[model samples]
Structures are given as C-alpha cells and as structure tokens.
Target: MSSLREKLKTLEELQQIDLDSNEVRAELETLPAKRAEIDQRVAEARRAYDEEKSRVEGNERERRQLESLLAMERDKVKKWEGRLGEIRTPREYAALSREIDIAKKTNDGQSEQIKALVASAGELQKTLEGKADALAEREEANEAELKGLEERQAAAQQRLAELDARRAEAVKRVDPGLLSKYENIKRRRAGVAVAQVIGMTCDGCHRHIPPQLAITLQRANSIETCPNCHRIIYAAEAVNPPAPPPA
Candidate 1:
C-alpha cells in the first residue's frame, strides 16, 4: 500500500512539473508574434519617412523648374527692352512694346508660382523633418522594447531548461509501464493523464465515475483509471489522507 501510494504521489509531482513546462512552452510560442508586431510598426514608420522624403524631393524639383522658366522669361523681357531705342517706326515700336508687355505679364505669373512653390517647400520640408523625427523616435523606442522582449525570451528559455531537467528526474521515479500509459493517455487527452476524483466525479473529463470504482479509488491500494476519461484517477483523501484529522 505504501509503495503504491508513493508511486501515485510521484506521478502527481511529475504531472505538476509537466504542467509548469507546458505553461513555459506556451509563453515561448507567443514570442514570434510579438516580434512580428514590432517589426510591422518599424516598417510602417520607415514607409512614412520615405513618403515624406519623396514629397519634399518632388517639390524641390518643381521649384527648380519654375525658377528656370522664370529666369528665361526675364531674359526675353530684357532683350525686348533693349530693342526699344532702335525702333525706327511707330508701327514697329508698338508691336515690340506689345511683345514686351506680354512677356512681363508671363514673368509676373511665373514669379508668383515660384513664390508659392518656395512657401510650400518650407512647409513640406518641415513635414519631412517631422516624419524623420517620428521615425527615429519610434525606432529607438521599439528597439529597446524588442531588446526587453529578447531578454524575456532568454529567461523563459532558461526556465524551461530547468523545468525539463526536473521533469527528467521526475520521470525516473515513475514505473515505466505506468509512465508509458500516462504518456499515451496524455496524447489523447490534451496532455492531462491524471485527475483527482472530486465528489465521485472525474476532474479530468468532468464525468461521473462508477460508485464502486470511486470507492476503490478512495482505498488507493493500486493505481486506477477513470473509465470515462481514461486518466489515472485518485481520490484526494486517499493519497494525501486529509492531514490525519488535524493531528
């Protein structure tokens, strides 16, 4: 009786260690998703910065073209003005004056456009600088956050290694056939191969155990399995014995 009791006790301890190991494994599983989420934010920030840079460059190109066109118009108006003194007839002078007037008007329009472009360039550059700052800040903060997550991953890995080592020791204490049975049951029952009987109910499957089986489990002379869940079942009072009625 004592030997069987000790074996069940060892199995229970092993189950607890396995459960802890499973918890650590689950934690490890989420690390990649966390990393992916961080990467996504960094990507988004980079894209925003790039878009702003593109806009600023495009605006600069537009400004340069407008200035070049404005300069050409000014040169045409100056050449037309130099012809003012050489006009020998009223008809030629009038036509040349009309050409000069039209050229000056074109120049005025181009100048306004250049002014608007220059004003927008300053604003665009400010937006570009703002985007750069945002990207930099996000990268810095996210890098730190990622580093912290890496540290947590390492710690969890170390913890799982310790738990696995303890589990190996626990496995050595259980009977081989019983341990094999437990493993088979665990594979089919979501990694739970043992359960306590709570009020004649199998805590594993939440199903009722037979009256006689419940009684047999309470005696705990040998290992027992729940018919419904197929899990190794024990009555709590049988193995731990309720502290011997408060001493």
Candidate 2:
C-alpha cells in the first residue's frame, strides 16, 4: 500500500497546480470584457469628434445661405432706389419708399445673422481641432493598452496550459483512491480538498485537532482529516517551512 503521507504530499502538489490554473482561467475570462470596455471608450471618442465636425459643417452651410439672401436683399434695395426718381403720385412715392426701407431692414438682419454664424463657426472649428487632437491621443493610448492586455492574456493562457500538464503528471503520482476522494471533496468544498495542520490547528477551519490526531499527522505516516472541515490534513512542516537562518 502507498504511504498515506506520500499520497497526501502528491495531492498537495496537485492542489497547488489547480489553484494556479484557476487563477489564470479567471483572468482569461475577465479579459474579454476589459477589451470591450476599452473599445467602447474609443468608439465614444470617435463619435464625439464626428458630432463636432458635423456641427461645424452645418454652420458653414447656413452661413453661405445667409450670404446669398443678403446679396438678394441688397440688389432689391438698389433697384428700388433707382426707381424712386420715376415715381409721380405721392402714393406711388410712399410705396417705393416702403419697399426700399423693407429691403434695407432685411439686408441688415441677414448681415447680423451671417456675422453670428461666422463667429459660431469659428468657435466650432477650434473645438473640433481640440477634439481631434484629444481623440488621436486617446486612440494611441488605447491601442497600447490593448496590445499589452492581449500579450498578458496570451501569457496567462500559456501558463494555464503548463499548469494543466503539471497537474496531470502530479495526479499520476497520487493513489487512485485518494485522488478520487480528493476530487469528490474538492467539488463539495470550493476546490480545497486538502488542508494543512499548523501546530494543533486545522488551517482549513482554524479548528483545533485532537491531540492524538495531531501526533499522527506529525508522524507523517498516516492520512487524516480535519474533524471540523473534513479536508485531508497534513503537517505544515512536511509541505513547506521557513528556511533556517544561516548558522
């Protein structure tokens, strides 16, 4: 029969591999969402730039329309002024004066509209320039961040594969019966099938182990389970210990 102590040691090694693999797996699962978040930021930045660009373009078009209307109004005023001398009746003279006045007022209003549009367009242009610069910088930074994240993801994936291979090898070194028991307990106990006995305490539950059982665990010859957590218990010094200081 395989020594229970040696079997437990193998189990401990296997458990460590599982723990390491689990961490890498968890990181891999979260990476996609992280990448998506970065992508969303980039998309929002681009949308902002496009919106500003559209505003500036719309202002320019409106300014052009206002200029065209102003020209038409000025032409009407000039024609009416030329016709003022030809007016004979007092009513006709009054009608000609009213037309000229209306045309001049319209021209002045259109000039003011054009002026406001030009000023607004100038501000919009400056805003668009700043946004473009900001967008460019953000895109560059996000690209670098994404590249680094992808590299880390790749490395984590590779590490998981290595851990899996190591776990397979480690499992083979343990007895089949013990491995079966460990797997069953691991499923029921949050992936921790083994626990270490520290002094007289079960590390799994921080509960005190019976004095006799503690002695047996210290002997490193028999397998034992913690009464509180039922996890396989092994001596802490057997698995790891603080290295002694240089003499």
Candidate 3:
C-alpha cells in the first residue's frame, strides 16, 4: 500500500508538469500566426493610404490640365478682339466677331470644367488626409501589439525551458513500468494519465466508479485503473483531506 501511494504521488506530480508544458507549447505554436495577423493589418492600412494619395494626385493633374486649356482659349479670344478694330469690311468684321464668340464659349466651358476639377481635388484631399490619419493610428496600434506579443512569447519560452527541467527531474522519480503506462495512457487520453476518485466519481471520465473499485482506491492498497477510462485512479481523500472532525 505504501509503495502504491508513493507511486501515485510521483505520477500525479509528473502529470501536472506535463500539463503545464503542453499548455505553454500550444501557446508558443500560435504566436507566429498571431504576429502574422498583425502584419497583415498594418499592410492593409498602408495600402489604403497609398490608394487615397494616388486618387488625390489624379484629381490635381486633371485640374491642372483644365486650367491650361482655359488659358489657351482666353488667349485666342483676346487676339480676335484686338483684330476687330483693324477689320475694314463688314464681312471681315462679322467673321472676327463670330471667331471671338466661339473662343469665348470654349473658354467658358473650360472654366467650368476647371472649377469642377478643383472641387473634386479638394474633396479627394480631405479624404486622403483622413486616410493618412487612420493609417498612422493603425500603425501605432500594430507596433504596440507586436511588442507585447513578442515579450509574452519570450517569457513563455523561458517558462517552457524551466518546465522541461522540472519534467526531466520528475521522470527520474517514477518507476519505469509505471512511467511507461502513464505515457501510453497520456497518449490516448489527451495528456491525462491519472484520475482522482471522489465519492465514487471518476474525475477523468466523469463517470460513476463501481462501488467495489472505489473502495479499493480508497484503501490505496495497490495501483488501480478506472475500468471506464483505463486511467490510473487514486482516491482524493487519500491524497489530501480536511482537518479531523471534532469530538
């Protein structure tokens, strides 16, 4: 009974260490994917900013083109008006007037186009400014998040190293046969190789343990396994109990 109790104690300790190690390892595996998600968000923000900038630049270019065309039309109207006084015949005068009218109308159309382009450029500029601000905020947030994740990963890695040493020490304390059984059970049972019997209940499978089996576990007479889950079972009260009842 004493040997069985000692073995159970050692196995329990080994199980706890393995559980902790598994949790840390699982977290470590997810860290890279988490970092990648942050990188993707930052990249998307930068792309949006670039696209907004290009749109504003395009509007400005269109406005400039419209202004140049308007200037040329205005110049033509001015030259035709100046030639009006030099025309000697009525036909010549009429021709000059017609040319001036056409030039004026072209100039007016170009002016309207330039005004619309300027307004569009103004609106695009505002949108670009908003995008720039949002991008800056996103970048700052990503940097902070990434820094925090990196720190957490480093700490987890250090903890894993410590757990590895603890596990190695624990492995030395258990009997080789018992350790082999534990390893096999753990492989099949989601890393849980030991189960505690509490009031006829198997903690591992949450099944009601047979009364006879529970009694055997309570005595801690020999190594026992849960019939339902096939995991080593130990009595919870045998491990630790509350203070004795008063007289």
Candidate 4:
C-alpha cells in the first residue's frame, strides 16, 4: 500500500496525461480542417480563372463573326459601285442608283454591328484582366495562410511529442495495476480517468459520495473508484483536506 500523498501524486500525474492526450488529439484533428479551407480558396481562384478565360474567348468569337459580316457588306457595296456606269437607259441608271443607296444602308448597319461587337470584346477583356488579378491576389494570400497553418501544425505536433515523453516518465512512477485501472476508466469516459474527492463529493459527477465510501477514500492509499461515475478517485491536498501534521 502507498501513502495517501503518493497516491494523490499518481492521480495528479494521470490527470496530466489525460490532459496532454486530449490536447494532442485536438491539434491533430484541426489540421485537416485547416488544410481543407486553404484548398477551397485555391479551388475558387482556379474557377475564377477558368470563367474569365471562357468569357474572353466567347467575346473574341463574336467579334470575329461581326467582322466577317462587315467585310461581306463592303464587298457588296464595291460591286454595286462598279456596275453604276454600265446601265443602258436612264430608268436603269436610276434603278442602279437606288440599289447603291440600299447597299450603303446595309453597309452602315454592318459597321454598327462591328462597332458593338468590338466594344463588347473590350469589356470582356477588362473583366478578364480584373478577374485574373483577383485570382493572383487570392492565390498569394492563401499560400501565406497555408504556410502559417502548417507551421502551427508542426509546433503542435512537437509539443505533443514532448508531452508524450513526459507522460511515459510519469506513468513509470505509478503501480501497474493502478495505471491499468486508470486507462480502462479513461477509455470509457471521455479523456477523464481520475476524480478528486472533495468534501464527500465525487467531482466526476458532482454527486455526494456515500458516507462509507468517503470514509474509505479518506484513508485509502491504493487505487479507488467513484461509485457514481466509475472514475478513479483520489484525495487531493488542494481540492481535499489532509490529516493534520504531527507536532
């Protein structure tokens, strides 16, 4: 049997081990979420780039089509002008002149269409430029954020490793049977294996421990368990009182 003080020390060490394990697990779990957020930002930027490129290409295609129509109209006008002097009679000449007027109108309409397409192409180009710049900025910011997250993850892992090493040392000081009991209870209850005996109350459940159990706990130097929560119990000098020192 160990002294009450030694047993309390062991329990405190177990609590520390539990705390460290929880911290390590929490840090590990957060890494994936952080990486996912950065990846999402990168994906959004890539999508913006692709959309901009598509819009620019579409506008270029429309502009090319309008230019082709304008060229056709101009060629028709040129041919009409060439035939203006070939008429045999005044009525035919007048008819040719009317045809020239209609051709001019058609050419003017085509010119207007070409102008509108060019303006649209210019607008699309501007949009693509703006989107491209935005994508680049987002990419840079995301990269920096990812780097910082990775550094934090590395630091967390290092601290966890150090804590595990210390926990191994702390475990060596406790009895094997006591350590086994602590591990079993910890696995069942979330990360918490030990409870403080605080004035006849089980801190694990905040319920009053029976008077008999309280008496046993007050005197125990070996492993004890809480009847209410099944967590290991120990009398804490800070959270529980100890017998008066001898004079």
Say which candidate scores most in lDDT: 1
For each candidate, what TM-score against the reference?
0.90, 0.91, 0.87, 0.82
The Cα error of candidate 1 at residue 226, in Å, is 1.7
The alpha-carbon lDDT assigned to residue 144 of candidate 3 equals 98
Off by over 4 Å in 2: 239-247
Q: What is the C-alpha lDDT of each candidate?
A: 0.89, 0.87, 0.88, 0.80
47-113: candidate 4 lDDT, tens digit per residue = 9889989988887787787678778877887887888778679998888889889878877886787
Tens digit of lDDT per residue, candidate 1, span 32-70? 999999889989999999998998899889889988888
1-247 per-residue lDDT for model 2 (tens digits): 2366567778889888987888899999999999999899889989999999999999999999989888887887888899889988999999889888887887888899999999898899999999999899889989998999999999998999899889889988888888899999888888888888888998888999899998887777777788889999998776454598999
What local lDDT does model 2 show for residue 164?
89
Better of 2 and 4 by TM-score: 2
The alpha-carbon lDDT assigned to residue 20 of candidate 2 equals 86
At residue 236, candidate 2 shows an lDDT of 74
The digit string of per-residue lDDT tens for model 3 on 89-167 reads 9999998898888878878887888888888888888889998998999999999999999999999999999999998
If both were scored by TM-score, which would come out higher, candidate 2 or candidate 3? 2
The number of clashing residue pairs in each candidate reads 0, 0, 0, 0
10 residues in a row with least lDDT, candidate 1: 238-247
